[model samples]
Target: MPYLAHIGPIAAIVAGVLILVMPRLLNYIVALYLILDGATRLLR
Candidate 1:
């Protein structure tokens, strides 16, 4: 799962940038991350 491992940091960075550049996107980014994370965990 090298791709998955690589994406984790990239996602974090994107979320960080979104938070910095447009604070409004922070909530959407966080919600998306959480939903995806939960889905992945549950599916696994």
Candidate 2:
């Protein structure tokens, strides 16, 4: 539970790096981030 608090910032950082490395993956990364964010919020 404590580690779950860090997931958002960590995921954002990873997504940002992935986007910078492969611009074409922007869409997928954003979508996946959104889905995960929504799922986490819903679960909470």
Candidate 3:
């Protein structure tokens, strides 16, 4: 599978859990995720 295919599900699960456990982290998680995703794509 392509990296993005894995990223979606993993990010979703992590974001979901984090949102439930620590709502404050939602923004950071999303920002980190986008940054990582963009970096990954650019680096690839």
Candidate 4:
């Protein structure tokens, strides 16, 4: 649970850096993020 709290910000930071490097990946990154977030919440 404690580690779960850190997953979000870390994911966001990584996503942000990725988007910056490849603007075209913005959509995919966002979609993946949303899907992962949803799955994690559901599991909890």
lDDT (CA) per prediction: 0.75, 0.89, 0.78, 0.87
TM-scores, each model vs. reference: 0.69, 0.88, 0.60, 0.81
Cα TM-score of candidate 4: 0.81
- Candidate 4 lDDT over residue span 1-44, tens digit each: 67877777888899999999999999999998998788777767
lDDT of 3 by residue, 1-44 (tens): 37655775687688889989999898898898788778666765
Ranking of all predicted structures according to TM-score, beginning with the best and ending with the worst: 2, 4, 1, 3
Q: Please give me the total number of clashing residue pairs in predicted model 2.
A: 0
Looking at model 4, the pairs that clash are none
Q: Which is the better candidate, 1 or 3, if ranked by lDDT? A: 3
The per-residue C-alpha lDDT of model 3 at residue 27 equals 88
TM-score of 3: 0.60
Q: Which candidate ranks first by TM-score, i.e. highest? A: 2
Model 1, TM vs. native: 0.69
Once fitted onto the true fold, the runs of candidate 4 whose alpha carbons sit more than 4 angstroms away are none
In model 3, where is the ten-residue run with the lowest total lDDT? 1-10
Alpha carbon lDDT of residue 26, candidate 1? 80
RMSD of each: 2.0, 0.8, 2.4, 1.1
Question: What lDDT would candidate 3 get against the real structure?
Answer: 0.78
Against the true structure, candidate 2 has what lDDT?
0.89
